[model samples]
Target: MILVTGATGHLGAATIHFLLKKMPASQVAALVRDADKAAALTERGVTIRVGHYDDTASLDRAMQGVEKVLLIAGTDEENRVQQHKNVVDAAKKAGVPFIAYTSRTLKDRSTMANLLMEGHFQTEDYIIASGLTYALFRNVLYMDVIPQFVGASVFETGIHLPAGEGKVPFALRDEMGEAMANVLAADSSGSAIYNFTGSEGYSFADVAAVLTDLSGKRVKYTPAEPSVFETQLAGRGVPDVIVQRVIRFLTDIKNGQEDDVYPDLENLLGRKPASLREGLKGLYNLG
Candidate 1:
């Protein structure tokens, strides 16, 4: 049996859908904090287990009779490290043979986006130290973020960011979901780390050009300094910590940390991942 945490979330739900194609629902469990939120999944034959990172008993209950578990990192940025630690501890206690963790693109070295990499690195360290067989799926920035650019273009006619014309390998969330399912289904022999990314890399300017071509509008890429970008986000009511993290992420792109595109995802999926053009079409509602 395989249990997936954060099953009610975007990537988790997608992973469950992909896993269902390869395995029976009885063999898969959706671990969520709220059972009511998972009614749809339950209707689809998934066994729902109420669980939370803070509650070890709940986690233990969810891990009952499960052979493998996918620990989808929690969204709570403040206590994420501890939350991940809790999950790792539970998995160790449950004696699960294989565990899969979702992480970021580059985590070895400190870049401008240290905030984003810190949690991933710490969680990865915890997983390695737990003496459990684990696979790290280090994911790149999602193409789903294109909607932020599209919304800005429609409202402000310009996209402003701290990343100044740097190219980054961006993968679709659906592709990442499929890759995670494939990794979970495979044997846990090597316990390798996979850097999941799309086939092509693109810069902010490249995204602007795609939007211009698709929308027939003059969309411009306006680059700002990290401080200025953070201030702008703060002015818009975003929390200071989150704004700072966003600025740091953009600076990492400017430094080209996310530019490397690897074939790991395609090799696992046995098909080419979605392209920027194809992802944009769905985001912009363009047929």
Candidate 2:
């Protein structure tokens, strides 16, 4: 059987949803914290097992008799590495043969500079050292969050960020979930490391042009300084830690950490992933 951790979250749930199309619900299991949130999965005949990353017993129990597991990344950025390690230890103890982890796409020389990259690299290393057969799905930024980053009425407000001339190859979440599902169900003989990304990269300026054309409004990109961006975020009541992390993220993007385009996603899906305009239209209800 296949068990997916954090099954109630966006990526996990979407992955399970796609997995069902390719396999039986009885062949799938969901390790979720909230039983109520998993009613949809339960009703669809998916086995729901309550588990928490911090609770080793829960993870062990959830992994019982599970041959494969999809370990989703935790949201707690500061302590996520420990949480992921806990899951890895349990998976090893449970004798699971294969583990697939959702990791981030990083430059070859990232050096674990930022909080996000640090946690992911730590988790990847721990999983590799765990002596379990594993596959690493290095995912790029999601296109779904672009609308939120750009703002609701972006044509009037403009695209505000610290990134300048850096292009991000962003893939849609559901498409990635589908690709991951394909990976989970396929034979394990294929490449163990998969870099999932959009077919093309887009900068804020390119996004502004797309929004302008789609919304028929004069959208523009405004690059802000790190201090200015942090000040705006703080004035809007964003938490200090989150504000700092956001600044770091924008800085990384500005430094071209997310600029590379990969053809892996297209190869996985056997077609072109959604373009920037297509993602924006679905996200912002633009025509």
Candidate 3:
């Protein structure tokens, strides 16, 4: 059976949805923290196993009889490294032959450092050292967050962010899910890595233009200083850590870390991924 961790999450659930279309649900198992949340998946014939990254024994139990594992990166920035390490060690103990990890885009962070990227790099290193056959999927920022990044009422307030001319090659969450499913179904020999990114890149300014045309309202991209941006985010009730992370995201983009455009995502999906405007419309209901 193929075991996918974080099965209740947006990406994992979407991946399982596509995986079922290509293969039998009986061939798939989900490692989820909440059995209640996995009811839909279980009804579709998936074997739902309760597991948490903090619990190694539970992960071991979830890995039983599973040949392949998709270790979806955890979201807890503070504890993600150890959590990922737990999964890697459990997979090793379970003797799973192949493990696919969702990682971030490969880049040198000697200048602008990213805490998320740092965790991903550490997890990649651990997986490599574990000696399991693996596929490293280095994914870019999801276009699903475009609406949130720009803000909910962007058409009215315009776009405010610290990101300068930084461009991001954003892909749809479901499309990325499809790509991951395809990888899990394919051969897993001689470990490989794939960069799943959009065909085109877009900056905040481009997003503003798209919003203006789509909504028939005047929308503009208003750049803000890092301190001002963080203050505004915190004032809006965003957590201190999250606000700092958002600043780091914008800073990374400004440093040209997320600007690389690649065709691998389309190659994996056998079609072009959705554009930023298209993705935004779907997420924001821009009708």
Residue-level lDDT tens digits of model 3 in 164-196: 888889899899999999989877667988899
Model 3: clashing residue pairs?
Answer: none
> Model 3 Cα displacement at 253 (Å)?
1.0
Q: Rank the candidates by lDDT, best first.
A: 3, 2, 1
Give the TM-scores of the predictions, in the order they appear.
0.94, 0.96, 0.96
* Minimal lDDT window, size 10, model 3: 106-115
Regions of model 2 farther than 4 Å from truth: 108-113
After the best TM-score superposition of candidate 1, give how far the Cα of residue 108 lies from its true spot, in angstroms: 4.5
Clashing pairs in 2: none
- Where model 3 places Cα greater than 4 Å from the true spot, the runs are none
Go through the candidates in order and give the C-alpha RMSD of each one to the true structure. Answer: 1.7, 1.3, 1.3
Give the Å error, residue 240, model 2: 1.9
